[model samples]
Target: MKCEDFLFLNNQVCVIVGAANPRSIGYATAELFAHYGAQIAILDVAVTDTTQAALRTAMSAKVGREVDLLCIPCNIVDPVACDRAMQMVVEHFGQIDSLINCAGIVRSEGMLDIPSQDLALMLDVNLKGTFHTCQSALAFFTKQQKGTIVNLASVAAQRGGGLVGGAHYAASKGGVVSLTKSIAREFGPQGIRANVICPSMTETGMLDGNVTEEQFNQVVAGIPLRRAGKPLDIANACLFLASDLAAYITGHTLDVNGGGHIH
Candidate 1:
């Protein structure tokens, strides 16, 4: 196979969940995939006509071509919503090739002091929401006998919450890790691939709004790479795992933490 062939998306339909803002990792992935010839269907609870238009404009600029973009207002926490949103994507695009689960929530409350409501919200959005989308997509994937799933986890899930998220957030992401592996194992025989990307302190809205400059500097100092990750950094990893380059890889957790795993 040619080097370029590994990265080519070739008009595949990629559904990105949790692309609420243009600065998010989901949007970055959508842009990169679009550049490689994928039609983008973005799902977010906050999606609006304005945000959709902006995303389409930005993606077209990046790819230097008009993009087929679908923006759906979807709350992944609802199974019916997930199913309906995916159905809409299929109806619009004809087929679903990949599903990227980036929909999640985070908070800075430790296990001992975490509020009950906060814990529930995290589980609902991070863990249960992932479950809903994966389950909904499974119907199409299994029927077609080919699909890819890339779920976003966090380093907090690996380290037990030392960064921005607290125990609840960590637990929810940890559940994502396990859930992704389960899908990989169960569906590998059916030509479905599932993997997780654990990003460490990415420079996204999720962290910017929650951390001060001092705290951010301290965290970066500890990282061997001496900088926080960018949404593009995580997006690149998604591109690889979603592409044929990773066709043989499944049930794997790719860490995009810039050597924070070493520290």
Candidate 2:
């Protein structure tokens, strides 16, 4: 199939977890999906007054057309909240065709310095939060016998964090990778596909929060592409995984690290 044939997501209801900020991968994925004609449901910790407005303006500009958008307030650490949020998406959009888990935290504290509370926070938000959201969305996918899940892991998980995040962060994301594969294995028989995207150094708020320019530049030197990843780079991959182009693919990990981490 041609590229254009594989790109459109018209009328599909897609739920993007953690689309609260403009620079986040979640928002970027939503924007790209909207551009491809998907009806978007955005869930975040709290949908601010500016949330809908910002999404409308940005997505409209992105696709050069008005987008169908829904905003929901959710805290994914709570399984009930995750379920309730998706329930609202189902009620509004009728059926959910895709779920993209982009909600996570980036921590750069030293391994020995990571406090118990901080470690718990990282695990709860990055690992358990993903678990809750996936579990909540699974019922719908299983009932429909057709669904796609695109989860966000990190290169830190693969390489054990010489880049930005700490050891604890890497561990949590490692868990995400394993969990994604488990979902794929368990649900593949039911026509549900699950995959993980592991990006190395992306130009997102998560990267900014953890790395300085010098650190980023140093890492960039080692990458074959000689540049940091853009949000669109990762968003485009998410688009493909959610589309029928990836129908035969599941439990796979796609790295968008500008060739930073080679298998």
Best by TM-score: 1
Q: What is the lDDT of candidate 2?
A: 0.90
What residue runs in model 1 are displaced by over 4 Å at the alpha carbon?
A: 1-7
- Clash numbers, per candidate: 0, 0
Residue 138 error, candidate 1, Å: 0.6
TM-score, predicted candidate 2 vs. hidden true structure: 0.96
Candidate 1 whole-model C-alpha lDDT, 0 to 1: 0.91
Name model 2 segments beyond 4 Å from true: 1-7
lDDT of 1 by residue, 47-122 (tens): 9988888888888988899999999999998999999999999999999999999877778876789878888999
lDDT of 2 by residue, 1-263 (tens): 77556447878999999887889889999999988879999989957768888877888888888887898889999999999999999999899999999998887889999999999999999999999999989989999999999999999999987578899999999999999999999999999999999988888887766788889889999999999988889999999999988889999999999889898
> What is candidate 1's CA lDDT for residue 213?
93
Error of 1 at 167 (Å): 0.2
Residue 172's C-alpha lDDT in candidate 2?
A: 94
